[model samples]
Target: MTEQHDEPRSGTSSPAAASPALARLVGMPAPDFAEHVWSRAPLLTRGSDLPRDFADLFGPDAVDELVARRALRTPFARMAKDGTTLADRTFTLGGGVGAGIGDQLSEDRVLRELAGGATLVLQALHRSWAPVQDFAAALADDLGHPVQVNAYVTPPQNQGFSDHYDVHDVFVLQVAGEKRWRIRPPVLEAPLRDQPWERHRAAVEQAAQSEPFLEETLRPGDCLYLPRGWLHSATALGGTSIHLTIGVHAWTRRHLVDAVLGRIGARLSADVEARRSLPVDPGRSSGSEVAFGEDAEVVRSLVAKALHDLSVGEVVEALRPQVRAAQRAEPLGVLDQVERATHDEQGGTTWRVRRHLAAHWEDAGDSPVLVSRVGRLEVSADDRDAVAEVLDGIRDAGDLDPRLRRRLALAGLLVPADVSGE
Candidate 1:
């Protein structure tokens, strides 16, 4: 039978509705957290320290529900035992009768693996699970970075994976049972996506031998923050342990550099000098090699010039699509959304950014355009502020012009936001 999950406790007010999720999550004020902890250091806070237990985010029931009843497909979930991932075939089978897709996760197989002490890993919980989806989306908005979620359900006294570090920062939220986490300083600090822990396995193994910076068993409601490249590992203490790992793919200087370099390359591509063929006659060179000295000098000069001419606006614009692709907000129900748009044509209901959209104003031939994820929206000069307000996530929709609201809604840029309590 298919099981549907509604809003699970969610602790305080809805993050998407009320306040910043980060403040409620980290057990510290948002500003303090930004200054002290963020990507700089590791922080471990007890549940009592937090506003409430993470019962709202996810729990044991969620684990069982995802593995068994969700008709979960492969890659969405996996299992590992003793630091090695179990083969997919061992726990997967094609759905029989009405269901035609192969590689669906076998509920019985999952149960067998669970009974035999394999750690069940539910990947990308932010996309599937309801409660964590809202929580993660709000966190992404709060952090101004992309966020992903995974759940690790380990058997008692069993460890899933060996000690290793991740390339992106992660918050280890202990949802249920007990897990003893050991934290260590990173061999490579604040590593980027290209730099996986596997690349530094030798150093990581050696570091694991040293005394850990922190070794604490987390009960429900406890939270641990580990910055990217910080080494860590955990084991279920006694009974089953379920924890949600929220990974923040924080923006870094490296990303900015890449964007700048990309723009530079793009600008150079239009230059005839950049596309000119290298010395066709290599035989004339001293060693018969393709003498790149003169060409290298010319290319260097062109790159330097391009860098000077490259605008920050161009770089930011180039990076928008990538950022949009990596992160997501709530999905819209088109029928209901359209109905709301039709009903609220007179502007009585509140509207929020559709999928938490980001946009910039540009002057097109026809007045001004609001360039957003959906497309360019040509707005009259007077109505731009109201549109901007909705994009800014303003709570007031009581006075918005009805026609403007309807246009924004149909454009896939704004949707009805239920911010009643807030």
Candidate 2:
């Protein structure tokens, strides 16, 4: 399964006396866990309070299968001189699998060349994987964006990657063993360069010109958050090291403008003036076709206005739920059959609801009432009576009320328990 790192420490200053160690790291203002701060700076913590028994999340057979498939790379992931590694790992049947498999690790090539059958482990964070999914959901809610997990295993002396940076911000968790990380200062601050592979190759060839701002060895339970565009490299120290990189998606004003422009383009073809033939110039002796100017300025202006409207908070808010819904929708379809079964007198009912664990929503003051078996609920003071009525049924039936239950079932909120007949 794709490994997940622990959540990074909140860099915010506590009113209470701070630890000397924490004081040193909290030099810059701690970034708010909003959409923007991800992958932008350094936030490190040692002996974190976050759950550390990462291996327990995966089954022994599954772990063995991943290893046997040669999915885990060792002794430094090999990269082409150009700093790009070709990825050939097939993704499992989930959204998380697709995101994790998209990237290449150096060891993948060596294993394939050696004719190994080990498959790369993919961890799914649906409601079924409750603990991990809970953490994921919290992070998504905190960050107001979708999050996915990807893990790489590097053996001692093996460098999983050459000196490079990611397009998105990453939270790295050291699950087991040790890894030495060297992070250079944010150079190309929030760079918009599209060709990261080429940039990585160039940076590697010119390593002598750059220096790392922070260099440290991360042991188990350590967490590091690195912002986008910061150059860094990691190598396993002396034993097998497993690390999780929680990547956050980046959105920009340019992306919003692009979307608006696309909408405008679709409407332009309907303009009769734009489609009309240019007026022919008969007076000229030359037989070349005359070109007339189409008034595209109006369309451009409209697109710019639309983009301006979208540049503020509304666009992100509008897009957030849609994005969350899409991620939440995936496991929902798969869990449908599981939610349909009725419980017999002898068997306990199992109900499963799929929730995207990423911190995708902004908590607007009031905490939304989220019940595992009932699906996501937005309760208001006015609806307290209704909510209590539903809760009454939940307490009695060990499920939601019938109408609400059917709705939740249809929404993939509650699935039938997979129970053996008594």
Candidate 3:
């Protein structure tokens, strides 16, 4: 059985200094929690680190700002009452005042829905909220996987959704008020993205009938980690409830197999024997010959050869490009970079690696290339050490090769370190 520890008794709230990446946010050593609880069991971390507070992401005022001022559209924001989703028209209207506006959130309609105990869901907060975007990017970088953020706001004594299981693991942060969570063991273990709770309603109901494995009221400053497929339901208690759910969509063995098979498919397409058409009619075949018999053997041999040709390294390398492509760079300050380029004499500027930009080194032909969110950039072997040094920590602009610094800065991989302080 996985060992469980109560609230961390003697740990510092320094995430970067902690062993695991997000440990500071959860109040535990990251490495220990990763090995003992991550994707293995549930954990409840209680703390009130003021600096790590999630007020910047969402709150009652933030909700009003998003719904009334952000000009959000359907799917981006949704309202649910008693577990059923309300229609878009229930809380949306044609953009009236703004030019080229599509759909705007109607505050009056949304308030009416909320008054009736409807839970407001702000989907994809990672895209809409800067704080959530940064939070997700940090966790994704640390975990080497993608992360999505969402917020749930439910009125007092009302439940948003019924007991259900998510296909992706989630880190639940109770941002405000309190929520009573009832959690039970998963009916299915580590279910795939396609495997939803609705398909096994009967089994879930049966499991919910049993004593919950965990039942607690999560107050502000509390956090919970629930692995994929863990059955759970929660209701706002006494006052309005607000929480942030960081969903981690972990990469699985199936993804690797698919990557390998995709390469195999390309190889099979080049084989003439595998491509040859089968007999049109088996009835016209000779005595012992059956329809598709000869072709089946040929296809089987081709598959065997393809499987033999597949290698772990090849599959991993093949998937790397896709991973790199998925990461997108944020809007760059082109004018600032241009101005900095002209003022090469200015040497006091300290440059740092851009935040949330996924970067890694890979072997290419005779040298290594730095693959970042922007694209794969080939650098000379002699400059690799310099690249490594810069990525390790903030560096003075004059300390770097002027050309290299300019290139990195223009590419959005490097930013002025002082920008954050500003």
Candidate 4:
């Protein structure tokens, strides 16, 4: 239950570190896992097996800051115990006078629930938490896919959810405490986003009873990878368990198929014959004999013809919007950015391409346009080089034409390269 209001609204100032993030994450060369383990099998890397631990990204204190200090609201924060989610009212109360809302998180109630063994879920950390946000952006770039971060805080000996499978691949980073994870292979391989584990609940329950493919206790600094559709369940051990689930929403063959078919549908919308009503059954019945044999055949033939005529360019163009929506743009700092852009003689100031801004150049006869989720900004022909250089990396603010710099800054295609968490 991700909330639209809770999505990445405020831009982050700190850009993700540009190191070989994935290589550091899995404790192996990035290519090694990409070639062998990604979407193919599970890989377990202990804390000592890696070049570093995830302390910089998130830890137990992060949870306190989010729940107690940040004034977090729901569907962003939730709790579950014994596989059942507690109601929102149990942890939320009125927003009070000037706020004029009813669903604000109640810190006291949250503490009560936590003390009673309910597992707290800090969802959408990529949007809500800074360190996780930076890390998510870095990992998304490494994986070439959309990624989301979720933190689970379970009391000792508690579990949050039942054995289930996700439609997206995930990397579980054990931040603190220990958890016993039981994993099994998919009952349905590479399940689509619409195909959840409950659809095969009977099969999943039966399979859970079988010997697990991997069963181990994950301590601090440990990590585990599971591809989409693999079944898993976890229970906290010792004192408490705090871990982050970095989920990868991978683009797959199904996306390509949808893109191709979607392009074909758009093309068919302009076809006069395709728009004509189907031949009315003489009997006006729900299912005439012709329904199965003749009428369905004609419709199928038309779609097949359109599919056969489809081009790769059409499919790619159709998929562009999805890509833009999935990939998050760099974080923006309104005050700092405006100052940099507006101030003259700001020669020493530096700024860089927005992280994951996803803006691309599009030729427009005389001028070029920067196309992205920020909407199109038609660029002046003279500033093309500066625009290109700025988007590529950190560039001197003075290097860009003042007009272009202001436009880029306002349009959210660039930001102060060194804006701190402030």
Candidate 5:
């Protein structure tokens, strides 16, 4: 049975009496929590009652510590008679530097400054941060793929970012402040790759050739969902403002097709189609003298089959489980221990094992029987039930039978918990 979790206020629109039409627009579709807004413009809505104390989500102390340690970049700006004037700047992190008036500021500094000054943006410091992780989990449940958080802080009367767009679909949450947003209709829809900024600039220039979309202000608890290639700019109103921009990684049909072709290419290496020799003639052959080998025909047929599989979306479906598994997988550490073998003659073999679990493992067929956060053993018809049962019976450091435990150790499934143990 597929499990559904309620969307978190920080990452998505809250379900507190939203209009039916608006609810449908924001709800992540099924199978996976992916939205169907491919090649569309941004959608805005008011009355999205977001959580208060959102600033505590990033921990002001941590922000202060990071700033004190010089672990972040800081860019200062002051309002001038002409426009915003650039003040002092420093690069504390490893990102490259540029000479533009505002480009010298680190993203960390820009984000923190925006958070302190604006209440409309949510600040999700890092994916590993608990609140950020929790917000991502909720989004992942809706988007189906892992969702990453990018924080932004917009100060009043100050432009947060230059006119541009992002490569991924973004859900902007108005956490605590007010900000004005000017978004152009989406052009060059579904553009991907790292060159989104360049593409956005080109698109905005093109849009400006016509009538540009005017600006709109977002008060606290408002949200805006902008699809890829929708150029936009934001500025803080008069007070400090902070917001969270949850970006969903774009997956396209073309990407799915490429992955299937790759998988088929791997399988072809083992078939006669791959082993066949190429036809050659010492003398230049006339049209009548040339003959195509059966192998050549076989290869042509194999490639056609691979293309057909891609056309049918089989490859995309096959990859979905893997993607889901990666989205749910947790990080591993040295202190974790597991039992790998059972010796009825004695008891059970216990040993400590260390390995990074696959980031996604929601589906049973994705991997052989293994332990996971959901519980110890998850068996399916496709698995060898006997092996899985045996593995499941072994648990913890002190519970394994000695003889079986040694075998498990040899298999790398178990190791001595105590380094000094004889």
Candidate 6:
């Protein structure tokens, strides 16, 4: 059984600092979820507090407002009728307020289609909606994985897409209304990104005819967790249904191996012997295979050498900064940043490392540096303590090296503590 822990101790460096983060979304703790249900089965938790947690995200009113007033264009918003995607032009038109602006959401057309049993989909709301952006950022940081959100508003008794399996794991939060879901086991277990449900259409359809992995109607405040490759379909019941799918694109061991391989490849390529040309004797037959002898030995030696040179810890350490850099950072204004760093040594302003930044100090290399999602900064030994202090948490501006603080702030790694929350 999944067990939830009390929220992490105060002043934890990251949201995920409390054990595994998957528990925050599900009531279960991370360890139990990973061992019992993760990548293994489906889970439905009813009467969850998610409805209140995400009360401001999306619903019938939000759909109406987005369709009528948001001036959204293609891709950002779309419609599907009876499992078929509808054309954008069918629900979009030129913005009336300006000429040659762009195609925008057509309220009348959207409402008409909805009335005709079409489901409206809002794509990538984290980029357009502030609250979603914040929630997604927090979740991503907590999970140590990239997260994206999409909202679906379906009419009563209507569905969005047909029975299909997602390539990424998803947590469906029933924000409003209710929907009946019919879910079956994966046709191909733990499918990769390229292995879509369409690849096994006949198999999926055949399986759908049999008993489902789960058959339940999720009401508001309920949540369902489906690992990637699980086939599922949902239809609204009684009233319009609205749900947010938080897709988690998990980073896997294969990725970590690849990262290590890349580092190994670079090191091997730098060796002169490893770069030597292969022996291609004119007398040798080129038919189907080449005779394996010294060439094979050389190849084996190269592989052995590469493996011998590889260091998992070093590769992983290098990877952390790259992953951290993938996150977006909020920068303090360049003008103000420069001013404070240059002239505000005595100012009362406090500064802190931007939240959710996977900041790491890399001192092993010849150039000691602080790397973060915002950017990387090369620093001298004298400035290492100051940078570390700043990264620890909120600190008085005067206590830090003003020049380094300004540089980090300018690089978008740090922000004034006051405005950082915004």
Question: Over 4 Å off in model 3, which ranges?
Answer: 1-21, 48-53, 100-102, 279-290, 330-335, 342-348, 360-371, 376-397
Alpha-carbon RMSD of each model: 6.8, 10.1, 4.2, 7.2, 10.5, 5.1
lDDT on C-alpha atoms for all candidate structures: 0.80, 0.49, 0.77, 0.80, 0.50, 0.74
Please give, for residues 1-422, the per-residue lDDT of candidate 4 as tens digits: 00011122211122224436675557555655676668987777777766678888888889888887777888888999988999999988776788656677788888999899999998999999988888788888888889999999999999999999999999999999999999898999999999999899999999999998888888888888899999999999998899999999999999998898888888788878688886666664666665656757776888988998998887877888898999677667678777777773456566566667777788888799878877898887877777877677656655777667767777877677676531
lDDT of 6 by residue, 1-422 (tens): 12112332121122233643344456555555555666667777654432244566566677777778788887898999777999988888888656445668889888888999999888888777776777777777666778888999899999878888998889888888889999888889888777888899999889889887678888877778888998999999988889999888877676787787788778768888778886677644754345546677776788787888777786887577557755566434677766665655676667766777677777866678776676667888877776777677545444766666667667777666676443
The order of the candidates by TM-score, greatest first, is: 4, 1, 3, 6, 2, 5
Instruction: Judging by TM-score against the true structure, name the best candidate.
Output: 4
In model 6, which residue pairs have backbone atoms overlapping below 3 Å? 3-29
Q: To one decimal, what is the Cα RMSD in angstroms of model 1 from the true structure?
A: 6.8
lDDT of 5 by residue, 1-422 (tens): 11112333222534333232223225322322233343344556554333342444444443444344433333222211112333434222344455333333354644554444422222334343565665565555445445676565445677645667777788776666688887776666677765576645666767745554546787765667787777777777777556767777766776676678777886677667576666675443554433545545677898877666544455755665546455543322233323323332344433454222222223456444444322344334443343334445444534444544454444344444443211
Instruction: List model 2 lDDT by residue over 1-422, tens digit each.
Output: 11112444344333122222212222222243232234445656564433243454333343345434434332112222123443443321111454354233333343453233222323343233444454555455445555666655555666646677777677776777888988776546665538463565665447625666778888876777787777788777877667767666556666666555554455445655546554555633464333223334544565565555544465444444446453443243345453353322233554443333223222445654543322455544444444454334444323445555555445454455452111
lDDT of 3 at 99: 40
Alpha-carbon runs more than 4 Å astray in model 6: 1-24, 48-53, 96-103, 281-287, 291-297, 330-348, 362-367, 394-398, 420-422
Model 3, C-alpha of 18: deviation from truth (Å): 4.9
Segments of candidate 1 deviating more than 4 angstroms = 1-19, 283-290, 343-352, 374-386, 389-403, 419-422
Which segments of candidate 5 are over 4 A away from where they belong? 1-39, 48-62, 69-89, 93-124, 209-214, 275-300, 307-422
What would the TM-scores of all predictions be?
0.87, 0.59, 0.84, 0.89, 0.58, 0.84
Per-residue lDDT of 301-418 in model 1, one digit per residue for the tens?
A: 9999999998889988878877767765456778877888898855466777666556688876657888765667799987778767756756455566777777778777766677
RMSD of 2: 10.1
lDDT of 5: 0.50
Q: Candidate 3's residue-wise lDDT over 1-422, tens digit each?
A: 11234433333335445333375356655665566677887877765642365675567787888888888887889888877888888888877755445556888988898899999898888788776776677677777778888899899999989888999999888889999998899999999888889999999989989998888888887788899999999999988999999898888887888898888988889988777776677564665556657767888889999989888877987788767665555544678767775565466666777765567888787689888777778888888888877776654445788888878887677877766511
Using lDDT as the measure, what is the rank order of every candidate, best first? 4, 1, 3, 6, 5, 2
Question: Least accurate stretch of 10 residues (summed lDDT) in model 5?
Answer: 75-84
For lDDT, candidate 4 versus 5, the one ahead is: 4
**Which pairs clash in model 1?**
none
**Candidate 3: residue pairs that collide:** 20-30
